[model samples]
Target: MPVLVFGSVNADLVFALPVLPAPGETVLAPGYATLPGGKGANQAVAAAQDGAPTAFAGAVGDDALAEVALRGLREAGVELGRLAWVPEPTGCAAIAVDRAGRNLILGGSGANQSARAAQVEDAALNPDTVLVLQREVPAAENAALILRARARGARILLNLAPAGEVAPEALRALDLLVANEHEAAWLAGQLGCGADAASLHRALGVGVAVTLGEAGAAAATAAGPLRVPAFPVRAVDTTGAGDAWCGVLAAALDRGLPLDAAMRRASAAAAIACTRPGATMPRAAETAALLG
Candidate 1:
């Protein structure tokens, strides 16, 4: 089954600093690097690069930026038949990372907010598809996409990042709720759960994977909580690690790997992503080496 991704695309304008500045303070950086980023686009690239049956359904502006976004997706092997063009400028993110992996970000909605209701209705959905979502798009659009996917009988796999107002019903509807520890805590609170595995599982109905960076990942399942350790690697840039993990996991599941084994491969792929600069994940050869 294919994984259908619906979300945002943004040009990541990154600044590297020796130390990030405090609020109301200033810092200096030597140079800047620009990359195609946005949770949805990054995850789609990850999925396609890892050889998932993947398609991206979203809007990008009818501008030069949009062309670049499209090129990136095409290079990653994501199906772009459903992507549409909007009138607004392309979305953009300003990112600052210190010597450490910590980052500060400021973003603009741009074309992401311009996705129309008609386009939402026209999303080509399939019953057996894995519907992956992220918070980079408008909240209403996200909800609308979820509703449409549900109508089309797709299984939802939501990765809640950059937090937004998601209803508890949405939580219950997901076949997989993938998140980092902090997002898990926030999700637990949103659903009135106690931020523990048991409560989180009860609220989301038992198929939730909580990722804890180097500590690894834990999932809440009917068979009980399952934990997987992270693959150790010398970390370089953690920019797109989470997106890589989410995409690779979705791909592995689509390829029929058992859930635990899928997480291991996902973790290993993410570790490889950390060793490389920028958000693009390692090629198929590198991923195969890690899997081997």
Candidate 2:
């Protein structure tokens, strides 16, 4: 089975500050580093590191930053044959992490806005395929891919990060929908429903998983509701934790794990990711060791 991620890619500028800047306020950092990041790219790396055959389909500029933005995915061995080179600048994210590992991020869509559903081929989607999506790209493109994947009987997982408008028809086409507490609440409001996992599942007619940071995560599916406790770990940077959870969950599902078991693995992977700086992913062995 293969996991396909169709979303954004970016070069992340990370600044470690004592505290995040408030509105109209500026904070000084000792130094900064550029890292490969973006919800989609991080998730693709996570899936590949977890030992799944993963492919990434997105757009990047034909510029110097493109390589930097693709480093992590390339290192993780994710196939990038479907990647596009656009005239627009590569997408970029400015991330500021405070002492508590909390972060504030501002992103420039750039080439990401040019990402299209046509980037992924029809042959890439099937019953054994796990198609992952995120909100960094255009919603219409994501919606189109969802419908296409649904028609091919692929397992579609949409991580509604940076929550935005999505077609009701696309929501109904998903096998699973992942979101953080804030995103979940926003989505609930959009659907005119309660902000709980079960309510979202009922309203959307699909499984819903909500990541609750240190409080762990909860999911609602036709099988029943499930709760996975967060693993105990000292946090370093929490930027890519949710992406790790989504990617690992997709990998687990592709490996034939049940949803409950997949959530457990995802929770463990997320904890491991929080212990690392930047958008780093844990390998399969590291995740298994932590799960034990």
Candidate 3:
């Protein structure tokens, strides 16, 4: 099985701050560092690091920042054959992380807005392919890809981060939907359903997984609800933890692991990511050792 990530890529500008500033308040950090990021790219790296046969389909600018944005994916062994070069500047994210590891992120779409569903080849949508998507790109493009992948019998996983308006048909087409508490609530409200995992599953007619930061994660499926407790670890930076969970979960599932087993791996991967700085995701061995 293979995993295909259709999403955004960005060069993350990370600033380490003592505290996140309040609205209209000014805060300063010692300095900032550029790192590979973007929800789509992060998840693709995570899946590849988890040992999945992964490919990334997206667009990047010809700017110098394009290399910075793509370093992780290339290093992770994610195939970039579907990547396109556009005239827009590469996407960038301004991330401010406090000493406590919480983060505030502001993104500039740049070249990411040019990413299209057509970038993914028809051959990429097959029964053995796992298509991973996020809200970082245009909703219409995602919807188009979702419908195509569904018709082709590929398993589709959508991480509804930074939740916004998505078509009902697209929601129904998903094999699984991953989201944090806030995103889950937003989706539930939009669908006129309860915010609980079971309610979401019922409303969407698909598997729903709601990530609970400290407590852990819970999933709702035909087998009923399942919960996994968070692995105890010292926190450093929580950025990209959710992306790690989603990617690892997709990888685990692609490897034929049951949902419960996959959730455990995803949880462990997320915990490991939290102990690292920036948007760093843990390798498969690190996650395995932690699980053991």
Measured with C-alpha atoms, the lDDT of residue 219 in candidate 1 is 84
Clashes of 3: 0
Instruction: Residues 222-268, candidate 3: write the lDDT tens digits.
Output: 88899999998888889989999999999999999999999999999
Sort order, lDDT high to low: 2, 3, 1
Cα deviation at 127, candidate 3, in Å, is 0.4
Q: Residue 196, candidate 1: how far off, in angstroms?
A: 3.4
Stretches of model 2 off by over 4 angstroms after superposition: none
Provide the lDDT at 254 for model 3: 94
Error of 2 at 69 (Å): 0.3
Q: What TM-scores do the predictions have? A: 0.92, 0.98, 0.98
TM-score of 1: 0.92
RMSD of 2: 0.8
> Model 2, range 140-199, lDDT digits (tens) per residue?
999999999999999999999888999899999999999999999999898899988999
Give all candidates' CA lDDT scores. 0.79, 0.94, 0.94
Scanning candidate 3 in windows of ten residues, the lowest lDDT window is 273-282
Poorest stretch of ten by lDDT in candidate 1: 115-124
